[model samples]
Target: MISQNTIDTVFETARVEEVIGDFVNLKRAGSNFKGLSPFSDERSPSFMVSPVKGIWKDFSTGKGGNSVKFLMEHSQFTYPEAIRYLARKYNIEIEETEQTDAEKAITDVRESMYLVSEFAKKYFHNVLLNTDEGQAIGYSYFKERGFTNETIKKFELGYSPETWDALTKEALGQGYKLEFLQSTGLTIPKEDRPFDRFKGRVMFPIQSMSGRVLGFGGRILTNDKKAAKYLNSPESELYHKSKVLYGIFQAKQSIAKQDNCFLVEGYTDVIQFNQAGIENVVASSGTALTPDQIRLVNRLTKNITVLFDGDAAGLRASIRGIDLILEEGMNVRVCTFPDGDDPDSFARKTPYEDLVKYLEENAKDFIQFKASLLMDEAKNDPIKKADLIRDMVTSISKIPDRIQREIYVQECARIMDISEQVLVSTLAQLIQKDIAEAGKKQKQEQKPFEVHRNQKPKYTGYSGGDPEDPRNGPPEDYPGEPGYPEQQQVEKIDILYHLERKVIEILLLYGDKTEVFEDVFLRNNGEGEIETVTEKKEYKVFQRIYLSLQEDEVELSNTLFRDIFTGLIAFYHQNEKFSLEQYLMRLQPEFAQEVTDILMEDEKVTLHDWEGQNIFSKGKSESISQYVTETIMSMRWFLVDKIIEELKSSIVSNPKEDNMELLMMVMDYSKLINSFSRKLGRVMSRYHT
Candidate 1:
């Protein structure tokens, strides 16, 4: 377990901007930093980091929290791992007591695997720099490829000896578990013994977005015809090739800064571009580019320029990736190297200025690139030209943005010498077919869930009688109560949702502030006279809200809002003071993010500081007593209105003998609702008036 003091120290020392800026490129936006959301694909910047609050919110995904939560969310690190990462980054010493054998045994399996991979990465890197064979072979090979010493170390280049058991023996000798090593794919296990997985190869460690070594890619130095040229670690707990992009850890900042990413096809291509002064690049590592990988870049930028190898095969492979990028709503540009050259070779041979100029001048939009490449094949053949136009329309249809799709269609029509109306009609047909197919797929996916839900017992909570039978109306002698049950599930507009949400939001934001409330109660005087007595009561905001809800037996309908309210009440009972950020630390990430959204949204509306904005006739903070009363009363009014509507509906639906009783019930409920509305109107005078 992490010591509380150590956690506090880490929190105090770690700055939100500094911690997150290591991975995301943040630009100043007033007091906060704004950038593209790392959690989702977005073009404009919706991710905000507020250093003053020590919290970050990704409005795109509704994921927000302090520095620790950001690490946990972005890197998939466990709580302790994220905490330790911050501590290490901020140079804070952890002061936890040593774990016992039982405790150590209970450590997370994935974390153990990560630790084993990290150890192997460092071990392999050290061997490359210090060992005799590594210096002679590995270092020589990297140098021969035109990589500088800085590039070598920046990528953590490494080597493993040809000896079968070098890494295995070293890892075992260092007290690391064999199970973890095998799970990380660092050691290949056999019946009698285990051997190293990347023996006799130079290693390139693949890192997560946060720079944690997840696995490795090894290149065989020898010219062995039968052996594979390159070998990557098998998929393990920590590594999924399709979901990870090579060099993302190093390239995310540059990608965000440039507002563009150069897509390449190899690890060497990414490194070479970075070495040649273009740092915003990532590679598919020789695998087919996937949507998951494209979304990774989409989080940083909306523009991607794919670099091809200047061959027909490379252009064909590169074209396949353009639709995937377009599907993510990203702009696709294509640039090809000179004949007989690829990204790595071009970057190595060309000067930085020339390379930059070449890319800038040659990069063409996907539509233009396709038209230029295919025009030759359809030059004099009208039949082939029609096919080309259809192919372009298919690519255009993949684009999610309507304006972009239209623009591409216009450009394609002009290039293919086809009528614009013809292209538009064809595009429309394809899009309609696409939507129909998508609808079918969606229904197929939802079918199983629908079946399960239908099989389960659903409760309407009706006391008696079939609700569909008009003969059985509401009970004539029904006691009209404030907390009345629903007659049947009606999906009418519920105003109480927003009111309940407001109450919860207020409690979360100003729950610790002391406020004086006026409480009125009925009492019997000695002369058998009923008198209204008023009492002045002092309670914290959270205390007042909790007690009021408890007294009225009111539970928020939204489960998320109810959970947050309950948690706040419980927290306030234990601690006299409340801190919003600290409260967030104790809750789960998803719950904490919801609370953060509520709090931040309230701030955006100038919750407590609305007075200077001239939007409120009265200061909210100064009129705390009235504010709380108004919120609760508004909620009560909504409930009364709901009941009134239900009663009216029931009376109209059931033309039975109990019509007189139901009418009286409706009148009485109407009177109550009118009283509540009057009270609510008075309290909301600042806005309503």
Candidate 2:
């Protein structure tokens, strides 16, 4: 467990804007910062970060929370992983206590495999840097390839020794379990005999977006005719080749800053670009481009420029990747080098400025590049030219945006000297075919519903343990009750649910501030007569809200609202000076999400911009006391009205002779409702007593 002092220090020292700025490009918007949503692709900025509140809200996707939650959602880091990342960013020393036996035993499988992979990465890096053979072979090879000592260390390049059992034995000797080693594909375990998987090879560590080592890709130094030149770690718990992109950990910040990514084919291309002082490059690591890999880069930026080798023959093989990028709604441009140069060789030999200028000047949109490349093959041959036009139309049809697709068709028609109508018709046919194919596939995959009479329905959130047990049916939910509205949403414009959410919003925003409140309530005067008593008192805003609700026997009807309500109350009760940032950081992700949604409600409204138009709007904080009083009184009246209607229903159902008591009860509640209306400054009153 991390010590409380360390967590507290980290929470205090880490600024939300500074932490999120590493992954996102934020521009000042009034008191907040706004940027394109990382969770979605959009031209407009919908993601807002409020440094004052220490929270971020992505209006596009509705994912809002503190800094730690952003890391978790963006990079898929676990809670502990997110915390450690923040600690590293803020330079706070993490003090973790020794784990008990039970704690160690319960660690997750993927996390265990990550530990083994990390240890292997360190062990191999040590061998490369410290061992005599490694310095002569692995280190020398990197240097020969024009990699600096700094670059080698930045990428954590390493070497595994030639001995078959070297790593396995060292790991076992160091008290690292063999199971995790085998699971991570670092060692091949056979009949209690294990050997290093990447033995005698130069190692390249593949890391996640959060910088955790997931696996390794190694290349053999010597020519062993029977062996593969480059061998990657096998699929395991923590590594998925199709979903992982090399150098994303190092390139994410640069990619976001540049608003573009340079797509490459291998690990060296990524490292060489970085070494050339050109960051914002990631590679697919020899695997064909996958949608998941594109989506990974999509989270950072919506523009990708693919750098291909000089050979024209290889260009055709990459066309599928271009279409995939287009299908993901990204703008993909292609840039190739001169006859004999690739990104690695060009960057290694040319100056940084020239290389950058070349890319900028030569990078053409995918459509233009394809049409130019294929025009040479189809020159003056009418039959081949028709095929080329069709091919261009097919590529254009993959684009998701209608305007871009239509614009490309026009460009294709102009480049091919074909009729615009012909190109548009071909593009339409290809697109219709794609839609038909997709619909057919969906139908094939959607198997007919199976009725398994003996199978019970699954309830993921059910606390009733056994589904097979007859007593464990569904949750005990009451939709008709006042305190539970989720089963039946009561958030209509005329309903009281909106008032419940308003109370929660106020508490979250201004709960710690002291306020004076006056209230009128009925009490027996000790003479068999009821008298209204007026009392004025000073209390914290949260205390006033809580006491008022408790007196009326009312609770927030929404589950999420109720959680935030109780959680905020407990947080305020414990701390003297409330820290909204610190409290938000401590909340569970779901609770924190609801809290930000409530607090940022006003920021999302158009009225917040009235000041910019020279038409100023009233600020809610200026009249918070009156606002709280009116909201609470209105809520009480709404609930009492429901009770009066219930009493009326009783009188109508049972002949009026049996409902005299109910009539008197309605009259008493009616008087309270009229009083509440008067307190709210409303002229018209109902059910006058």
Q: Which candidate gets the maximum lDDT versus the true structure?
A: 2
Clashing pairs in 2: none
lDDT of each: 0.79, 0.81
lDDT of 1 by residue, 376-481 (tens): 7788888988887888899999986676778888888888878999999999999899878899786675454342321322221233323322223333333344
What is the Å distance of residue 669 in model 2 from its true position? Answer: 25
- Backbone clash numbers for all candidates listed: 0, 0
Per-residue CA lDDT of model 2 for 1-689, tens digit only, reads 78778877877787778888987899888888888888767788888888898888888878888888888777767678888988988888999767887776655566678788888999999999999989999999999999999999999999999999888999889888989999889998888678889999999999998899989999998989999999999998789999999999989867875789999998899999999999999999999999999999998888999999899898888777988898888999999999898888988998899989999999999999999988888998999888888888878888876778888888887887778998887888898888888996655543332224333222223333334232233223322334324332223323565787888878877788887777677876798555667788888898989998999889876676788888888998899988887787688777877788877766664313556777755666666666777778888888888788768866876893777788899888887776676666631121110
